[model samples]
Each structure stands twice: as C-alpha cells, then as structure tokens.
Target: MSVPSQVDLASCADEPIHIPGSIQPHGFLLFLDAAGRIEGWSANAPEILAGQLQLGLAYTTLPLPPACTDLIAECIDLLAEGEYAPAVAAVSIAGHDYDAIVHGSHGRVIAEFESRDVPADTVAMFAVKAHSSIERVRRQRSIEGLLETAVRQVREFTGFDRVMAYVFREDDSGDVVAEARRDDLAPYLGQRYPAGDIPAQARRLYVLNTLRMIADIGYTPVPLLGAPGAAPLDMSFGVLRSVSPIHVEYLQNMGVHASMSVSIVINGRLWGLIACHHMAPKRVPHAIRMAADVLAQVMASTVQSIEARSDAELVEQSAKVRTALVESLLIDEEPLDALARHADDLLAATRSQALVSVHNGKIISHGPIERETAEAIVRAMPADASDILVRDKLGEWPQDVHASVGKWVGLLGLPFDPPGGGWCLLLRTEQIEHVSWGGRPEKLAQVGPLGERLTPRGSFDAWHETVRGHAHPWEATVLANARLTQSELLRASNARRAQLDSTRAQLLAMLGHDLRDPLHSINMAGTLLERGAVQPTLGRRIQSSSNRMQRLIGQVLDMSRIDGGMGLGMVFEPLDLAALVEDVIDESRMAYPSIDYSFANPGPTCVRADGGRLGQVLSNLLSNARHHGEVGRPIVATLAREPGWAVLEVANGGAPIAQDVAASLFNPFKRSSLHNPRNRTGMGLGLYIVAQIVREHQGEIAYRHEHGQVVFTVRLPLAEMERAGPT
Candidate 1:
C-alpha cells in the first residue's frame, strides 16, 4: 500500500482513521439499522460466516447459530433504550466458535466476529487474575512503583514480549517510565517519543475508545460493502475498525507484529497509556484484554491518589506563605513595603528567583531585575489572560515581542485593578535539561516496495539532546495560592481606600468649623472701620476679601457634609421660580459689572422645591456663567414651563470644556485649571453644589457644549398653579 507523505504535518494530522470503511482480516464487521436489517457488511463476511450475506437481509434469518443472533438482538434492544455499551459473547458459527462483539454507532448497530484462536477463560478465572493484578498495582504508594508493578502484571497476563507504561507530558510528548520485558529483547525504558509520532486526532481517539489492539500488523484490510451512494460508515466505536496504514508501517519498522494499548485516564483527561508489544503475530483473547483494562483503571486511580497527596503538601506550604503576605497587607500601613519584607518567602513559595509588586503606580521589588526589565515583563503580559498567568518559555510570546528572556526563561503574573492599575510578577531563571528519545523523532521520506513516500523512521536506538532556555513548569498549587492572595489584596486595598476618603472628609469639616470664628471677627473689624470712616478704602477691600473667604469656607463645609453622608436638609414648598432667577441675576450684575447680562423670564412659573436651595442653585449657575464666560459675551438666563415641569437654562459663550474635563465637571474638587486660571476660585464647587441641590429637589440637571455655547439645564416637577405665591 502506498502511504501518504508525512512531509505535510497538517495533512498527516488530518488523516481520517476513524471512517476507514474496513476491518482487519482476523475479524469481520456487520452494520445494521435499528430494525435489525443488515445495511452493510465487510467484504470477508461471506467467507467467515460460511454463507452468502446480502445487504437488507434480516440478521435473525442469517445462517449463524441461535446464540450469536440472540446476543446481537439483546444489544440492539439496549441501543433502543439509549443504554448501549459494547458487549462480547462466545458463540458457535458454522460449528466453529467465535467471539461476537456488539455495539451501537452512528444510528446503527455494529457487530464484529473474531475467530477464536484460544479458548475463552471462565468469568471466575478471569476475575481472580484481574483482582490479583489490580491489588498489586494498588499496593504501591509512589507512581513509579505503581507503574513498575502494572507493566510486570500486564506482561505476565498477556504474555507479550515487552510491556511499557508511558506517561504523557504537558506538551504531549511521552516517556516510557516503566517497563517489563524478556531478557533477549532490547530495553525501551526511559525512552521518549515526540508529540508528532501520534497526531492530535489519534490522541483524541485514545481518550474516546480507551482500549485498542492490532492482532497482526501485516494482515490485509477487508473493505466494507454497502448500498450505492451510501455514506461511508462511521466506525468510530467499531471494535474491528481498520487501523491506519501509516501506523501499521510504523509498528512494522519497529519489529512489533502485534500490539495492544490501554488508556490511563483520570478526571476525564488522558493521563497516559499502558502499551504491550509482541515480536511475533499474537492474538490476545477478548477476556484477557478486558482484564488489562481493569488493571489500567486501577493504575490510573493510584496515580491520582499519589498526586493528590503530593499536591496537598504543596498547598499547606503555600497557605503559610499566602497567610503571611496577606496579613502584612492588612496590618501594615504601606502594603507594598510589607510585601517587600516577605519577598524571599514569596519567591520561595512559587520557586522563582525574583519578586515584584506594582502598587499605587509604584514598582516595589526585591530581586536582581532592573526597573526597565520589570516594566517590560509587565507590558508583555497578555491582556486577555485571567487574573493569574504562567509562562515557561520565550517561544510563547506574542509575535511583536522579542523571543528572548535574557537569563530568565519563565514568569508568573498577577494583575491588579486601578487605584493604581499594575501587575505583580515573579521571574524564574533558565534550567538546562538532557532528554533521550526513542529515535531521531523525525519522519523522513524513503522508497518502499510500493513507492517513495514518507514512512516511520527505521531506527529504534536512543537519541539524545540537550534542551536549554526553559524553566521548570509552574505547579497548580502555586497558582491556587496566587489566586487566593490576589483576592485578599483586592479586598484589603478597598478597605484602606475607603478609610482614607473618610478621614479626608472629616479633616475638611474640622477646618471649615475652626476658621468660621476668626473670619467673623475680621468682618466685624472691617465693618467698624467703615462706620468710623477711617481708611474707608482699605476697609472696603478687607470686607471684599473676607466675603470671598466666607463663600469659600461655606462651599468647603457643604462639600464635607455631603461627603460625610449628611445630605442637605430641605423643606419643599411652592414658589415663583422666575423670581428666584431674577434675584440671582441681579446679584451677578453687581458682582461682575463689566459683563453684559440678559434674562428671559417666563412670569410666575410655580415649582415644588425648597426656596432657599433653589435660590442657591440659580446663584451658582449664574456665577459659573460669569466666571467662565467670554469677557465681551453676554451671559443669558431663561425660565420656561413644559408639561408637568419647570425648566431653567443658563447659557454662556466661551470655549467648550475639554472632553477630558467635561466628564467630571460636576464632581467635587474639580478645577477650572484648563479654563481661565485667573478665574479659578472657591474650590471649583459651584456646579457641584448646584447639581446636589437640584438632585435633592428630585430634579434632573444636565450640561452640554453645543453650537459654540455651553449650556446648563435644570428640570424640576411643577407645583399646582393655585399654590403660586410671592417670595
């Protein structure tokens, strides 16, 4: 047979081994629909059954003995109930006993018949051997010991020339960690196989099927016969499914004629495999293979148990480190400084050479790494990665970055959210490793009897390589500990920020209270000097400065009160909103005599609001217009009545607020720094206080820069017209 070239790795991986539409010569397969009518049959079916087998023929009417048909019928019944699993039975066909394996696949019942080359063992006898093998495997505490016992027991049970336990690594390459073989056979223990040796699709099938066998690698493949235009039968679950030609060639090159593999699966992931090889053509009876499956399962559970215990120890140590670091963060006033104190412990816990924490936009680190290197490492982190990330090699970096990590080859990262958004990183130095492969681990093109095509490498000798620029992989327990630490740091950081905000507000309130008495004394002194007509000009200037100071102090007190959760107290009543607007405009005209002013008064618009708070809102909005408006432009104010509401609009002509500053225009402590700096005054609380007063009245306020003009609008619910009264 001409095998496809392996030059194209993608094509080699795409090879469809599942629907080969054939079976090995030692067994024949028959595909039947739910009604028990034969829809397809292997080309060798007639020869094996000793009678003609036709498509569309009822299986029960076949010339097989009654036992085989009854067994198949029961399997078909199970398929109807959605409980179908592979079942095997011994039955006589044409006076010769055969092993019948039945299962359901692709909406059809698949039956396979393998000629009996050896007598089948009784259930009691197989159970005794299986129990003995499983017990031996379970008694071992370490994974190495368990695998060693498993290979020995499987080799004894199957009588294979060689048996090896192969464990897969994270990269899918595998090592033959344990082996049992005859004295004359060459040892394959500790030999590694490349991931490409078994394509990706083949690994997936191993997980699904779990157990597979090839009685003879040299046997001819018998094709299946089906109706015209019928889709190729899906033999994914077929017991007698044909093996891939390339795989058959691989085994022959290795001098393995017969082979069996049982999967070691744990927690739904393919962990490893138990592979058995024979130098001569050998057929393992169905019962022996089942026993090997049981032994494999026991080995898998024992491995899981050992791993869990190992992880538990690591977790205990990790908990101690995490607890210390978290306590430092919560107890110490400076969290980054606290982390620095425990840098060595943090590094040792994750097996790293360096530790760095990015907090409050500052890099605090205790390691040999430079500040530039730390920044680069943080920038290299994948934005889409979750809270924690692990990297062991430079090859995994994104394309735009350099494929080098200097002296270090691995890193672990934890990203912190804003207040100061940054990352914590741990770096690991490179470790050199020496690896031994079963062969060169490369597929080469060679001319065989059929043609010049890609075939398995001929050499089975060990090949060695020195691997460099990689670090020991990060463990699961380390990541778990990092996640726990990340969660605690976030919580404690939030608590600290809240406490700081509360303290600042309390300080502001205290300063506002303490300065009021001194300011009142200054105002009283200025008033006396003006009444005495002594230095009247100086007295007026002093009074003017004191009035400005008084307003600034009042705004500060109002902001502190709101921030401290004491909301502005208000008494709602009906008043003429137009009158309030006119009074505020009159005051603004006096405050800035040079600026032109205009008012559009919708007379006597009644509104439900606290008259004092509403007057403050009008005053603040007018003051904002006066301060920020263009020197020659007129400040305009208007009041209007809409359905169920009263609308107040204040407009000024000037440069619109920058997009960056406009978003926080009404937020406390914002400044007009980007505007006319000379006009900056009163802690920038004018618009903020106005917005708060409007909200307290259950009104909506909005600001927009449109058509080269900045406008502020307030909408409040209207009161009954009958309640309108003069203020």
Candidate 2:
C-alpha cells in the first residue's frame, strides 16, 4: 500500500484532532463515507457520543434515522461539493444535538471528533472550546453571520445568566436583540434597555475596552499601584478593553453579580457590545478568560451576520409594503384604506402597536384607538413635541377596557410631510410585566407631578404608574427604522414639490422675458410718435422701431414653438452667405442705432439654412454684442468656409467675459454682472436661443475672448446644407 503524502497527513493533523486533558474524559474517532455515512468508527466513539448517538449512528450504512437523515445528507452534499471542505461541520450527534467538528476529503468524510464536555457550570467554557475551530472557519463566511455567531457563542460559552447583544441608537439609546441564557433565568431576548441606564460615561468606557470582566463583584478591589508607596503597575487596559465601575454598580442593583463585555467593532468604530451577565458571583481563570476573549473575536463576525440578515429581511419587507401602499395610492387613490388594510401586518412586522391618525391641526380619524381619546392625547402633548409616551398612568383607564387592551404602552406621532395637512399616530402596547427600567425609581416620580393625573379605577387605572406600565420606549432599532422610513418619504415629497415649483418658475420667466422686449419697442415707438416728430429722419427711425418690434414678436413665436417640440421647417434653396451677413448687419444697426456695425464675407458662398431662423440667430448675436458689449465699438460679422463646413464669426470690442461667466453665458436667463445697465433690454435668452437654433441646423457655436474683445462663432456642416438645398 502507498503512504499518503506528508503534506496531506500534516493537513489532517491540523484538522479537528481530539485534544487530551479536556473537561470530559471520553474521546471519539469517526470516519464517514463520501455520502457522510459511517464507513468506519473507533471503539471509543459510543462512549464519547453517549447522548449524541444520533450523530454517531448517522455515519453508518444502516437505514438513516428519520429525525436527522435529511440534515446529515444536506451536510454531506455540501462537503462533497467542496463547499465545506476547508471548514469543520458542527454536526449534532444523535439525541445530543450539540456542536461537533466533522472533516471531509475528496467528497468523502475523513474524520470527526466531539469537543470535550464539562460540568453544567462550565458548559459555557466547554462550548467555547468546541466552537473555536468552527469560529475560525466562519471568518471566511459572511461577515454579518460571523458577528451573530460570535455573540451567540459568547452567550452560550460563558454560562452568563443572560447574554445580550446591544447596539447604539441614534437617540443614544441601546437595544437588546440577541440573547442567550440558562433556562432558570427569565428571557430577555427582545428587551430594550434605556439610554439612561448605559449613560454616556459607561458607554465611553465600554468602547475604550473591547473586552471587560467583573469576575466577582464581591471580590476585594486591587488597590491602585501608586498609593504613595509602590510604583504603579502601569496596568492600563487595551483600548478595546475597559471596565465601568458604575455599570458594575447598576448590574449589582439589578441583582447581577458578575459580567463580561466585549465591544463589537465595525469599520474600526464601536458599533455595540456583547454583554454577558451572571446572576451569582463567579470567578474565571486567566487562561479561560483568554480563551473567551479569542472566541469573542471570532464570534464578533457572527453577531454582525445575524444583525445584517435581520436588517435585510426587515428592509425587504418594508420595501414590499411601501411599494404596495404607494401603488395602491396611485391606482386606487385611497391611501387611508391602503394603510388600514396593512395595519396588522405592519404592526406585527415592526413589533409595535400602530395607530393611524388623520389630522388637520385637529384629529380627524384614528385607528387602534378611540378618536376622542386620541385627540385628548394629542391635545395633552406639548406644543413643540410631536410624540410622547406615558407609562405610569395605566391604572386610570376603565378596568374592563384596560384588561382587554393589555398593559403595553407606547405613543408615536407622525406628522404629515407638510404638517397641518394630515398625520399618522402609532401606539404600541406590550404586556406590562415585561417592562424593566434601569434608572432610579425617583426619576419616575419627577415626571409624575404634571397635571395629567391618572384615574385609579377602570381603564384609567392602567395609566396610573404609567412609567412602569410601558415596555421600554422605542428601542434603537425601532427608532432607526422609523426615522429611515420618515426621512425617505420626506425627501421624495420635497423633491417632487421642488420640481413642480421649478417648472412653474421657468414658464413664468420665459413668458415675461419673451413678451417684454417687443412691448417695450412698441411703447417706445408710440411715445416717439405722440411727440409729433414727423421729420423724415424721425419717421424712418420710428419705422425701424416698428420693424424691430415685429421681428422680436416673430422670434418669440419661433422660440415658443421650438420649446413646445414643434419642428422648425427649412426651405432649401441656394442662398448667398454674404447677403445673409449683410441682412444681419442692417437689422442689428436698425435695432441698436447707437452702435456701429460691419460685415465681411470672404467669397461668394452658398449654404442651406432656414433664412428666417438663420437671420434671427445672426441678428440676436449682433444685437447681444451691441447691448452687452462696449457700445460705439464696431461689431464685425464674418462668414467663411473651412473644409467640411461654413463658419460665421461675430466679434465685438467689449469687456472680456470672466472665465466663470463665459462658461454659463449661453444658458437661459444667464447674464454677466459686467453687462451694461442701459442694455438690460433682453431677458438673457438671446444667446441661448441662438445656440439652440444653430444646433438644430446641425451646427456648433462657441465663445472666446481675445485682445480685450469677446467673439461668438457658429459652424454648420457644409454637406447638411447641400442636402437641405439652400436658404
């Protein structure tokens, strides 16, 4: 027989081999087939797998047990596919559905070993050992699962009466989501701890030390190293490790005598804590604690996993519901009905009792509570406050009603995106016995004196001692989800409102500017005519003003049509470029009689463009130069042909445009601060319209400044002009 390679044997050695001197004396050696069936087993397997017989028997060829055959088959399939090749599979053995390490090779099970078992008091310690290898393998799995597993392992390994995974809330509160403890202790799986209980200082210390231990609350304190005698031991803990004395006192007050805490660091910042609490005084050896710390690190990833998965599920569900609501509103135009229909589902999904309220400064409709009662509650709320919770006055309510309603207490006020329109209110009530407050009872007394006294009989009795009647007010996760939902809705509403307002503003500005220029010219002509200046020169000037007004009116019509998506029809006919330039010059001279105008055409050039629109573009550019550029400085218009296209250049001796202004010059309603006050006659749309018209003709326009002057140029494709025939 050939021997296996040393590397392969070494790899197997690194696998989950039985470690001697474990708390449990029994040892197990198991061999599984490619299908995870028991191909071979050692004599010691039965002794070690005592209570865990199901798992040991699973490896056998005998008919698989009905209880776990499917689970084993699934694991074997995963191993065969190499998905679990590098990782140990924590398979349950028979009745003992605990954790064990199973290794596989080449689609076949190679070896398996059960971790040492220990005393019930030390089961948590043994679990830690059992999970170390699996924990390491989990690092390569999902990060979120890694965190959840880490937390679960810590809780199960430390023998803490209760282990909680807590995360910080935006409101500085903390929530308990994942919890594990012995059967003797009450479950705190979904409890929420108040922010006041943790306090700012305690949280700061918890973050400083990622790992902390209160081995024995009653143990004597190790005095400070420097008591004016011996030098300090310089025993400062790791930044990820620190103990809070106040927290210890708080726990002691709660009857907890020992605790261990580790920080859950995400992206190098403290995300939350994994806290393990022991009800009775306990002492852990240094080695065991070190092992716990290592396991804690491994388990952090698992805790993160569970949180992420849970959050993803919540978000997905929320999205589905939100989509349904939004679609229903769009389709049926009945938002209230849609919300009502989903009330129970939303409440159960969010783990809160929700009340929907419609209000217009006064309550209109409410669900899950009487309208009169809701209004009274709303009226009693502080003016500036939108939400309030009263947990102390539960006994005041009518006894029959209170009994039916349960002892849960929570109040949430959701104002409409634009307040005073209509709003929503959600109230959650949990059974009263589950409520626990970490703060002093005296603090509860302080809020009791408010005139809102609770009646001691009937439904009102539940309102008495209100502080103690409610489950801890909104937890970090609940509040965060609520805020996220509200913010998204607010953002969408604001964005839509902004878009509508922008469109309205743009339309109004377009109308005012487009009509103002022609109106001004007509008014000017009428004023001049009323003065009785009938001289030949004055008559010609008045005629010119009327023509300019007519042209402006035509430009406005064309612009409106273009903006309305109406196509600009072009008449293709051979046209002289020189004539077009000359016409533009004459029109500009007439429009701005005070400015000098010049034209240059290099040769007899023929091109095709809509004569009216092309002339309007040229006239607008020249007019802009006369009004915005330096007046009295000659405006020069030039036309030339380059290889594939014709180019028209309008140059003016004017103040150079600043680089920033030049960038936005062609945008609608954009005017440089340097524009002349006397020429505020245009609505700043001349260049914008010019660019648009030119682009429609398959041409390009650009602006540049040189030698104390700014120049605008238009380039049109020569071939396109030929296809269009002419202007």
Candidate 3:
C-alpha cells in the first residue's frame, strides 16, 4: 500500500480523541450535571440498568446497588467540596460484580461501571504486589535496568503475553527499549515506531489519564445518548474510553485482541508508555489496573532520578570548564582571544567535533572547517535569532541552507544576548543511521465503506531503513553544557561592560581635574594683562594656556564619538604635509621650551587628509615624547614622500613601552602610570583619538620601539593633484 501524504498524517492528529462520545462495550457510563441530574447516559445503560435509567433524572433515584449509589453520593460530595479526583469502588449491580469509577468532569460528574471478569484482589494483596514491584523497580540503578525490571513486573501482575517499555525521542517517535514476553511471542525490543502511530491528541490524553485499557479491540463502541443540544462527553479521564478507530484497526492488524498502556510521565511530561498486549480478550480488574498505575508512577519517578543524576554529573563537569573560561575572560587578555585559547576545553565540554565563535563580524574557528564554510554557516543563521538552536538532521533543514552547511549534519548554535553580542557554534559531521522500524512506519489513505480515510498499515514485520544526512544525536548532557557556557559568556560580557563604564568614569574625573590647572593659568594671565602688566610673557602665557584648554576639550569630544560608535567626521583636502608637520613642531617647541625638538622634511610632501585632525595627531605624539623621553633627547619629526604615498615618522628616546601597557596601546584610557605620574594628569584619550583620526583619513599608523628609540609612523596616500603636478 502507498503511504499517505504528510497532510493525511497531520489530519489524523486533529481527531478529538478526548471527547470520543462513546466507550468500549465492557463498561457503561453516566454523566450527572451539577444538580445531580443524569444529563447523559451510555447506549448500553438501558440494558444494564433494566430500563430503569432516564436522562435528567437525579442519580440518587437510580436503581443501583447501595454500594454503587453510596460511592456516587460520596463522589458528588467531594466534587461539591472542590475535589475532582476520581474515586472507584467494587459493587454488585444486577447480581453481577462491577467496578464503579466516578469522577468530576466539565462542571459535571461522570460515573462508569466496568464488569469484572475475574475476582477482585483484596487491598492487602494489591498493596503487597505493588510494594514488591515498586521495590524491584527502584532497586535498578540505570534506566535500562529499571525499565527492564518494570516491564517484567507489569507482565507478571497483568498476565499479559507481551510487555514492553517504550521511550519517546525528541521527535516524538518511540523505540521499545525493554521488553518481557512469552517465549512464543516475537520481541518488540529495539523496534522503532513513527510518531503518527500515537498522534498528538492521543499523547495529550495519555498525560491527562495516565492509565488506559482496551478489553477487546473488536468490541462495539457504546455511544452516549444525551439530551438535545448536549455536548459530547469529555472522556479524557475515562478508563474505558473508546479509542480512535484507526488505533483499534492498528491493534487488530498486529493480532492483539486486548491491550493496556500505563503512561510513564517524568516531570509531568509523557516520556513513554508501559504497553501490555494479550492474544485473547482480557479485562483487568480495576484494582490490578490501579496497582499497575502505582507501579508505573514509581517507575517514572525512578527514571527521573536516574536521568537527573546523569544530567547533574554532566552539569558539574561543565561548570568547572565554564568557571575556567570565565576566569580567563577576567584576565587582561581580550575575551575572544581567551575563548580561542580555551577552544579545546569548549569542544570537550560539548563533545562536539568543532567549535566556532563569531563576534564583531569576525569569525574564529577551532577545527578542520574552512573559513568560507564557517562564514556561510554563520550567514545562514537568522539575523534576529537569540536562543540556542540544536539541529541534528541536516536533511530536514531547508534546501537553500544545505549548500551552506556542507557535509556537516549537526549544528548547535548559542546566540549571546543583547544584539551583536556574539555567537558560538558547535559542528558535527554526518553519521548514517540504520534504523529497524517495527513496520514500514507509514499509514495509507484508503477508500472504504466510510469513504476516503487514513488506515493503519497492515504489517507487523520488521523493516530496515538506512537514514542518511544525520549526525549523532546531541545528548542531554551536551545541551546542558551549551546552555551553561552561554550563560557564563553573557555574564562575563556584562562584567566587562561594567568595568569599561568604571574606566570611563575615572577618565572623566581626571579630565575635569586637568582642565582646572590650564583654566586657572588663562584666567590669571588675563587678569594680569588687564592690570597694565601687558608683558609679552603674560600674553604668551594666556595664549599657551588657552591652546592647552582647547586640546583638552577636543580630546574629550573625540573620545565621545569613538565610544558612541561614530567615526570622526572629516573634510578631505590636498595640503602640504611638510608644512603641517612643521607648524605642529613649532607649537610643541614653545609648549615645552625646555625640551630639545628636531624636524626634517624632504621638500613639500602633499597628501589628501584632514589637516586639523592630523595636526592633533602630531601634537599628541610630540607631547607624549616630551613626557616620556629622556630629559635631553630631541623629539624628532621626519616627513618623506614615497611612490603615491607620504610617510611621516615621530621618534622619541624613551624606555620601551611596558608589555602590559603595550597590549592595549591604542585603546581608550590607556595611560601609563609607571613614569611621569604628574604628566598623566589628562585623560589617556590622546593616543586613541590619534589612531581613530588616522584611520578616518584612510592612512596607516604603526608604533615600534627600535634602535634605542620609540618610532610612531603614519602613511597617507598622495593626493591625485599632488601626484599629477596640479593637473
């Protein structure tokens, strides 16, 4: 048979399995309204109650045994008191023993009576059986051992021919991981089943009602007959709820006459099922079913404990790696550089084939991946993506992305918070999987007596499939490690930002203090000149002090622009580079008259540049030389012309820059306190501003300590007019 289209499989999930409106023939149902009136009764109720039941009649007046009536009354009282938990009791109805289960549903009460085929177990017997089973389950330390034990105990308790513990994968498909069965039966262990076998609505009901039993797959559905305009009864908690027609056909096709499933819910999620099957019609008494429910609960709890312990171990191990990475980030080195250094640790932590980091539009990889592949993979990520993405099957991804992903079939990407923060990606190569499915794992839409509808595949034989373009599934431990690493990276980035803010605060405070001295000199000189002491020395003092104040203010403004991500604005023009250098040298000579200054120019070297910014650069470099150089050494400025370029060098005699300070030489607020502490009165924005302005002019700047002197070089392209001789 041809498999159904994806649409047909999805439509199956939309069936309203919760409100089936009917139940298996083994039970009778009645729904009572808030006033105790019977608003709904199953079609089989008339024959079971000897034609004495009627809709809208009070349940208290029904012809039921005192045991059944008393249980219903108590269930009603509990509902009146806001308790909705279901209550069950053994009762004799029409001389036949039955299990009366009552529960509140949708502001009404549901009463169901299931005929008992075998004698009910005493409470003591049930307790002993449950305790022994639960103890056996709890004693198993591993999940596989625990599930194996659970299946054996359930089969022993229910006398089922086959029992299997099935576990759901991340995709909702399931695998029978453990099984206990009669020697005559074929084992379902290790057989995979597709997600369509259960459907979404069925999975939901499984969570709502943790235990379900189908006494006979071929039994007729007993539909509920209700008052006019009455809504379909909600059988979400119904133990005898009539399952989907497709599910019934599915079991028949597998040669199963009866079935029972107890949900394995871990942390409130339907993790899997303890499925039981028999070759003959088998109706398990309510007590045995309840005992199985209890055992399943214990099994779920034990599984949770085992898995939690495993995850906890991984978290502890990853925490150590994350702590080490964070500590490296706190050091003086760049954060990205630190991440590169710890790339091996990250790979080990995630157990990934490779790792890559993308920040500030730069990519750093630590594996066999080429730069182009890494760039393409990063580009394929959503621009607004902010959460961790884990993809194991590259074949399932969009076709457009496949080309970019290349041979890698798995990608785990963790995006940092606050846009443009950064991203980390872990990559894995493809690993083909040979899966053994329980059947062909497909349903077919067939035209039958009821028209076109999906039917379960009529095959139970083992089928083999070769799955390609998939990587090894990322373990829960790996995912947890990725989350932990992402959290630490965010925390470290925030801390770094905080430290930068503190540094900015200190720089501003120092700028204010440095301004006061220059401002006071200007004010005092102006007062002296106004008092008829108009000496050339006082006039020069005012001019020098005013210039100092201007330079100080310019540095502050330039720093603000750089910090705000705004580059320095420039007006490009052709100018004599030598003249600009000479003018700055003369100004600096006067500013520090006590220090020797020298200048050399190879004629007029013209370049297109921002003249004022370039002058600021020269003044800052000269001032830096005077403040740090030997007291008697000359601050030399040399300008030369190269092919299509103008080169300028500023050489100052000084001890080489400290390794620590040189690490961030052009970074803002990087003043050296090791020498001339008084000269460090200004904010350390001079060198940073110079670097920024040089970059804006399309020029190159470099610093070198060689030949017993520190040399700062700037290279700018010669202007077209300068190169072509005024053409």
**Top of the candidates by lDDT:** 3
User: What is the full ranking by TM-score, best candidate first?
Assistant: 3, 1, 2
Candidate 3 all-Cα RMSD: 12.5
RMSD of each: 21.4, 24.6, 12.5
Residue-wise C-alpha lDDT for candidate 3, range 1-727, written one tens digit per residue: 1211111122333568787767898878888887789777777774656365666678877787787777777777777766477788888776877788988877788888888767544545755776799889889899888888899898887789999999998888999999999999987888999998888888888898999999898888877777655666777888878888778878988999999999999877889899999999998888888889988888888888888898887788788888988877664324555677788877777778887787656567898888888888877777677568889988666678787777776888887634544778888888877889999998888974346887887887889999888898899788877887878887887786686788878867777787888889988887887797767788777776787788778777877776555567888888898999888888777767888889976778878888888888888888788777877888888888778878899998987887777756666666563224757455666787887788667677878899889999988889887777754
Can you tell me which runs of candidate 2 are displaced by over 4 Å? 1-203, 212-234, 238-287, 331-338, 341-350, 359-367, 375-409, 417-420, 434-472, 475-727
lDDT string, candidate 2, 1-727, tens digits:
1211111112222111111111111224444555564433333345444334332245544332333344455557777466342223334454443233344444444343333334444655565574674555366465444545655666554656777777665555565656667778666555555566554545555554466666566544322111122111111232111133344445665577877777766555557677788888654433344566556555556656766787777777766766654444332212343456566655654566556544335343434565555555555444443333233234643354454444434655444334433345567665455434333222222222122322111111111123345444554455665655555444544553454356447646655675566567657767877997554565565565666556555655655554444545666566676688887787667756778787865765667677777887887787777666776688888888787788899899987887767756655455442234755445555776777678667678889888977899999766555545558
Model 3: pairs clashing at backbone N, Cα or C within 3 Å: none
Q: Local error of candidate 1 at 416, Å?
A: 3.4
- Report the alpha-carbon TM-score of model 1 versus the true structure: 0.63
Q: How many backbone clashes are present in model 1?
A: 0
Q: Would you give me the overall lDDT of model 2?
A: 0.53
**Each prediction's TM-score against the native?**
0.63, 0.34, 0.64
